[model samples]
Target: MPRPPLPDDVAELFRRPNPAVVAVLLPSGAPMSVATWYLVEDDGTVLLNMDAERARVSWMREHPEVALTALEEGSWYTHVSIRGRVVRWEEDREKALADIDRLSRHYGGQDYPTRDRARISCWVEVTHWHGWGAAKAD
Candidate 1:
């Protein structure tokens, strides 16, 4: 099936730094989720970052399929859940750190502390999205 287009309102919602949770499939086929920071690219892909050896990253690497839910800062019901697959992985230290910093400013207001390990940047191509801000179906 063709993916849905990300409307302006939904795109704007993703621009904000809110609560985002990523779900990936483990080796055993079980689902695992983690809270993460993300950026929505102009091409509609979701940019996610983490330690090179993190479980989430490993799962995504091995499985490639993942889901992300970006929620409103103060409202749990206001959110967008995206189902996508990892389309690329960028492993440059400088770029990865910068990305985390960019994400930090969006979510935490500043920089991310302690960047000791190598970072992995995963770009997921969005295939589907569900829910809308507060209470409207988009």
Candidate 2:
């Protein structure tokens, strides 16, 4: 499906130096939020990494549905929100390790060797995306 338009300020928030923090809703209706180094691919998918055993990961396992939002540090008014499902999760030990390396190199400014030492991680396939920013308003 075609992705919804991302508000200009929201887009800029994702383009910030620090990775955006996302809030994942648990099956119990509680929200588990965390800061993650992420990348938005040209295909309209947002990729994030977290330990498999983390609360959000556990919650996602039970309920793959989730919502993600990102906002600039100083301005809560400027932000983006995405509602979607986690369509894929790589549980293979080797692949998860490799993904962590790749993600770190891409977002952490580290070389391959340096990147491999980062935490193990998993992927979240964003099936739908919708966001807006206060900065985009008149």
Candidate 3:
């Protein structure tokens, strides 16, 4: 079946580097959540990046389920939570680096710092969402 497209407001929320968190499950069946940067693709899939060798990367590779939350910069009351899975994982060095740079520009004052560590980029398809304000659930 086809997936639903992200609404304009939810898409805008993701456009920001605004505070965001991602939760991935551990091998022990516990949840591991962390703050990070994210973006929305043209098809409404979510984009996230991390160090290629990070524990989260390993966990995600084995178990794609994830829940991500994004909150407005200045308001704690406004937020969006997405429950989904990594639909696409990209390891191409150039593409991965570019994605990180794009996210850095959103949150960081500049492009992501150049580093020797390889990067992994994941595209998440939104399966469900619950939020407030414009992102509010039906």
Candidate 3 regions exceeding 4 Å error are 1-3, 92-96
Clashing pairs in 3: none
| Deviation of model 1 at 120, angstroms | 0.7
Q: Which scores greater on TM-score, model 1 or model 2?
A: 1
Return the lDDT, model 3, position 86. Answer: 95
TM-score-wise, the better of 1 and 3 is 1
Q: Can you write out model 1's per-residue Cα lDDT over 81-107, one digit (the tens) per residue?
A: 889999998884867588777777877
- lDDT-based ranking, best first? 3, 1, 2
User: What would the per-residue lDDT of candidate 3 be over residues 86-126, giving only the tens digit for each residue?
Assistant: 99998738765788887888677677887678998999989
All candidates' TM-scores?
Answer: 0.89, 0.66, 0.88
Provide the overall lDDT of each model, using Cα atoms, as 2-decimal numbers.
0.81, 0.60, 0.82
Scored by lDDT, the top model is 3
Q: In model 2, where do residues sit more than 4 Å from their true spots? A: 1-17, 73-77, 111-138
Which stretches in model 1 have alpha-carbon errors above 4 Å? 94-96, 133-135
The Cα error of candidate 3 at residue 68, in Å, is 0.3
TM-score of 1: 0.89
